[model samples]
Target: MRLTFLGTGSAMPTGTRAQSGYLLRHGDETLLVDCGSGVLNALARTDVGYEGVDTVVLTHHHLDHVSDLAVLLKARWLAGETDLTVVGPPGTSDLVEETLAVHEYMQGRLDLTLRDRTTGTFDLAGFTIESMAVRHSMQCFAYRLQPADGGPSVVLSGDTEAFPELIEFADGAAVLVHDCSFPDDVDVSNHPTPTTLGEALAAAEAELGRVYLTHLYPHTEGRHEEMLASLADHYDGQVTFAEDGLTVRVED
Candidate 1:
């Protein structure tokens, strides 16, 4: 499986980064996680497209994570396609309904399957998607995606602070895409700081294979290298700073 980072910026966007969007592809099936601003444009830079994306998994209702959802839905309808499935937290169905309600003209133009997921695993195409409740302001969730064919798994910790449950979500995964919203010394609430992430990684040092930090704020712009060095002390695995358009292949 290959995972591509479409947007690595935080709630606020920078000149180089967009927001929080990632694309996971295995064979013909493609899944998108989070559709922030500029996500569709970012996908244009790659071989993926609205038509090729079969499922969209959302972490929360934060605008930075879901602002462009309506636009994506509209574009798919205009392109004469209709099969799309969305899996997210409790408010996912309501959010989609409200988004479509505002664009009432586009309602019913496409067939959409919305699943309001909280916890546990579900089958999506050929993958087993597991969600865990995360510590965030709003109702948020982190996802663990494992291919049914038995390959390396990936965990995406969407917009969350460092919580004990994260280790469970990332257990035995090949990659952990975590939210590192602030620098090491910059303290914040409901978001992971480098220091907090460091502590978390220290506890799960053996279980993780690779750690990639994303959802960076402008505060972390010039300190990417420093963050990696500090995190390396806690996590023995490869530590990478996620950038827009960055792609990594998962191996078992």
Candidate 2:
């Protein structure tokens, strides 16, 4: 499996980064996690086209994560590509319906499948997509996408305030793509700071193979090295700072 960071920035966009979006691909299947602004443009830069992305998994209803979803769907329909499935938290179906309703012209142009995910296991084209509720301002979830054939699994901790549930959800995963939004000193709610991440790692010390930090805020722009240093104090695994367009291959 290959994971690509389409955008690593937080709610706001910066010169070096876009918003929150990622692409996970294995063979012909491409699954999109979070479709923020400029995501379609970012996809154009990669080898995958928007039409090839059939599944979308959202972490939460934050605008930075789902803002450009409708735009992408409309563009795909205009480009003559159909068959789309979007799986997300509780409000997923409502969000899709509302988004399509606003763009009524593109409603009947494609087949859009919407799945409202809560806390349970779901099957998606031979892959097992498991979701666990996390502690966030709004209803949020962390996703673990595992191939039914027993391949490597990936856990994406959408946006949360480092909680025990996150540690449990990420245990034994090949890669944990978590939200490291702020610096160690900066305190923020509904987002994980480096200090909080360290505490969480220290508590469970799960055998997480690799850790990739994403959803960075502007406050963390010039302090990437410092953040890595802080997280490394607790996590002894491979630690990486997610950058726009950076891709990592997952192997068993």
Candidate 3:
């Protein structure tokens, strides 16, 4: 399986990174997770473009995470694509409905389906997937996926503060894309600072493979080394900041 970071920035744009989006490709299956503000063009830059993707998995309803879902749909519709499946948490149906309501022209144009996963394991494309609730201002989930054909497990932590449950959920995975939204000096709450995230990882002692820090805010500018050092102070693991267009092969 291969993972591509399409957008790694937070609500605030830095031009260098888009919002929250990722592209996952395994065998012939493709899944887009959390299409944010600039992700449409970001997707366009990928080899697959928007046409090759037929499914999107959203982690939460925040604007920075979901802003470009409609744009993707519109782009696909314009290209004569007729079907799309958008899978998300409990409020997905309402989210799609309300979104279409706002853009009345898009209603009934495509065979758009919404799947809601509140808990438990489910199949997505060709992957066996599980999800867990994370610490966030709203109801959010971190997804764990293993390809049905056999591959290393990959975990995508949406937007959450560092906690045992999130770490435990990602335990043993080959890769974890977690939110490290700011440096230790930011004094954040919902999102994790380097110290908080490192503390959480250290406390759990889970073998979380190579963890990638994402969901960066502009405040993280020019301070990547210091932030990484801060996280290393508590959790001694291979951690690095994720950037847009960064592709990583998920393998042990």
Candidate 4:
């Protein structure tokens, strides 16, 4: 699977990093994970523009994550696409419904389908996805995806503090893109600091191929090296701070 980082910043927008969005493409199918405020513009920059994205999978209802849903749906509609499918946690349907409610102009312009996958495994965009609940401000989830045809697996830890269960869910995946929202000195909650994230990674020892820390806040502006150093003290692995528009491939 080829994954692209559309937006990597936190709720607060950095000029370089927009918000929380990621794109995964395999074969002819493209699945977008989380569409934040600036994600639609980012998507336009890719070969698969907003019109080419067949489906969008959201992790939660946070504004930073789903801000562009209406915009994307409208973009697809204007591009002459007839349908768009959205899959996410339990409240996904409600979220979409309310979105259309607010944006009354967007009611029924396109054929919209909503799927709530809160448990078990399901097939979406040619991948078998297993979801688990995560620690967050609201009903958030993390996803583990394996392409039906083959290749390595990828895990996405939506927006959560690093925890053992989330790490275990990511075990053995080729790539684990997690929520590292700030540096160690922030004293924040509902998001992991680099040290805490590193400690969790060490305790679980998932041995993932490469760990990309994303959802960065402005406080993490110039602290990438310091943050990596702190994380390396506990968990030694191939780690990087994901930047907007950076694409990563998951292969065996």
How do the residues 190-235 of candidate 4 rate in per-residue lDDT, one tens digit apiece? 9999899999998984668899999999999999999999999999
Candidates 1 and 3 compared by TM-score, better number: 3
Clash counts for the predictions, in order: 0, 0, 0, 0
State every prediction's TM-score relative to the real structure.
0.95, 0.95, 0.98, 0.97
Candidate 1's TM-score: 0.95
- Tens digits of per-residue lDDT for model 2 on 89-159? 88899999988888667767879889887899987865788988887899988889987667899999988
How does residue 180 of candidate 2 score in lDDT?
A: 89
Local distance difference test, each candidate: 0.85, 0.85, 0.91, 0.90
- Candidate 3 RMSD to the correct structure: 0.9
- For model 4, the run of ten residues with the poorest summed lDDT: 101-110
* 251: Cα error in model 2, Å: 1.5
Residue pairs in candidate 2 whose N, alpha carbon or C atoms collide under 3 angstroms: none
Best by lDDT: 3
TM accuracy, model 2:
0.95
Which stretches of model 3 miss by more than 4 angstroms? none
